[model samples]
Target: MYRERASRVVGGAVVWESVSDGVAPVRVLPDGCVDLLWSSRRGLLVAGPDRTAHLSVSGPGERWVGLRLPPGAAPAVLGVPADELRDRRAPLADLWGPSAAAPAERAAAGRPAAVLESLARDRLRAAGGADPLGARLTARLATGVPVAAAAAEVGLGARALHRRCRHLFGYGPKTLARILRMRRALDLARAGVPLAEAAARAGYADQAHLTRDVRDLAGLPPATLLLG
Candidate 1:
């Protein structure tokens, strides 16, 4: 149900196959590159190399405004209320909305700065007071530490961390950590390193752990994408 494609906009070439109609909890692998996701009724969700997720709904139609957020910007932007956007029938749509065109147009127009400013304004309005635990957790995630250890390091219990992460990032901390780790692994793989090496460098227990993380996040085995 979920589909994805890696493409080069300026070159106008389909660099990767598109993932279509994905089910909930889709795993997007680390590809050593970034992407701008657009769906007809699902709006837009921009994911970063650090496993940050940003969701936004398009006004209507195919016109979209692209916002190239800085790394670590998701926590700040995912401030919108879930119920206010769309029905939770489709988790993707509920996270984003049904307007994918605005971002496309913004990208074509080359006004990413302006688009980000607008998104920031909207986020500020939706976000409640900042959650310090979320900030601390993100910092630990960046280091590729295990979530359990990270939670303890931040003086938060596992359940408390999970609740706060869901409230802030729309997913659990473990999910975010996997995404982040996969992203890091992909970076190493793309750099021409061995998969096993990349996995270890990214903090996986071993190559198998790395493979599981990559498969869970990217929906493809690490070797398939990187080695093939």
Candidate 2:
């Protein structure tokens, strides 16, 4: 079983899981987010933003917990450009050094999700945290605004916006906009909207545009995703 809820302490989602008697297939779709994960077997790790779907295997009887940080939060809290970790997963100890053991120890005490939240809180507090402008940019892009307008709203020129996005989101604004739009369409499709209608509502030029974008980012056609 998999469960998740919003975490007030960390301002993201806390996810927990219990795997039963089979190695379940997990499909991780790109959302431009990053995660701090802890497992009884894996200890502490970071999951970076993916540009396409990533499939992973989970063994039976395994337990995992994670705190998913929103798009801009990881760069500030982890003190690394999001580009460095793009499509990558790394041990927390390797990135943060021996001091990283502190969070692992907290997780070992039994509440891994809460420990992940505490880790985020402490890191954000110390780093003096996420750029509000980045969050605003994400919101604007999510609303189907053009990247130029979003950049202007955030007071950055086009090239400057690209640089900021590369640093904070591991991609330029155009790619971010594509991913966001893909997610919007996927959500609408999952909610039972017809593909063409969902594409229109999510700001695609047409159903074919939506289909191509979905395949590019999700590694599957809409019908396959919807069926599975």
Candidate 3:
């Protein structure tokens, strides 16, 4: 079973939990987000932004809880550049040290998801909150704005924009654009929109184009993911 909800402790973050029972590996699609996780088997961990889907398998009956930080919000709380942690999972102790990880893993309420959010909230405050640039960039691309136009609107030339985006989002804006476009298309399709119409609404060249992108980024076709 898996479920998620908006976080009370961290703005724009989602708290999710999943319990596995030896089913097939789960395909975790990329959505330009980072995660702070606690595994019943592994203790505290950090999941970095992904350029493509990640296949994850936990032991049977294992419980997993996580805080999914929206694009660009993780760096402030993690005290690490997003790019440095991209495409990988590391123990929280690796980033925050054993002592720091211990207290969070043993948070007061004994609820892993709540503890994760509280930890991120405290760390985010210490770091002065997430960069406002993240919201601006996400807003533009999510509406299907062209990357160059978005960059120009943000007052950054190509190189500067790329540099900042690499740090803030773990990838350049163009890649973020693609991820956002795929997400938009999938959401529409999941809502029962026709494939062709969803593609167009999401700025794809055609339904075929949307299929290719979904396969590439999510490791599945649109129909399969929608069914999933």
Candidate 4:
């Protein structure tokens, strides 16, 4: 079973928990976010942003909880560039050493989601808060704005924008825009919009364009995603 709720401590973040039953693998699609995950079996790890889909495997009855941080938000809390963690999952202990072990210990006691949120809240405070630029870029790009236009709106030149995106989002602005657009299309489709209409509304040239983009990022076409 899988469920999720919005995080009160982190803006644009979600608190999610899953219990695997060994039925099938889970397909984790790109979402332009990073996750701090705690597994009953594996303890604490950080899931980085992905440029494409990720397949997750778990043993039956394994419980997992995660605090997912919005794009541009995690680099500050994790104290590392987003690009460093891209397409990777690293133990929290590897990132913060002994300090990271405490949260895992506390989470094991119970109320894992609350424990995770407190950790995020504390670390975010210590880091002087998540990067505002990440929120800004996310807001602009999510609206389907062109990368150049988004960069100009954010007061960044091309090279500067690419550098900032790599540090904060783990990809260049063009890739970020494409991923965001793909997600938008999926959301619209999920809302019962037809693929053609969803594609057009989400900034794709047409349904065929949407299919190619979705397959590139998610390894499945829109219809398959909606079926799930």
RMSD of each: 9.0, 1.5, 1.5, 0.9
Q: Is candidate 3 or candidate 4 better by TM-score?
A: 4
lDDT by residue (42-147, candidate 4, tens digit) is 8889997999999999999999999999999988778999999999988999989999878889988898889888988888999999989999999999999899
The TM-score obtained by model 1 is 0.56
The 0-to-1 C-alpha lDDT of every candidate, in the order given, reads: 0.52, 0.84, 0.89, 0.92
Estimate, for each residue in 1-228, the C-alpha lDDT of model 1 and write its tens digit. Answer: 212332222221122223333323333333212223333344444544323322333332433323332222345554342112211222323444554346545634654434444544566457642445555676678679888899888888989877766655556688767776777888889998888898888888999998776666655777886754
Off by over 4 Å in 3: 107-109
Tell me the TM-score of model 3.
0.95
lDDT of 3 by residue, 45-98 (tens): 889799999999889998899999989888898999999889999988888786
TM-score of 4: 0.97
Judge candidate 4 at residue 21 and give its lDDT: 91
Of the candidates shown, which would achieve the greatest lDDT relative to the real structure?
4
Position 192, candidate 4: lDDT: 87
Weakest lDDT window of 10 consecutive positions for candidate 4:
1-10
Question: Which digits, one per residue and each the tens of the lDDT, describe model 2 over residues 7-34?
Answer: 7644544555555445567778899888
Looking at candidate 2, what is the lDDT of residue 200?
Answer: 99
Residue pairs with backbone overlap in model 2: none
After the best TM-score superposition of candidate 2, give how far the Cα of residue 170 lies from its true spot, in angstroms. 1.2
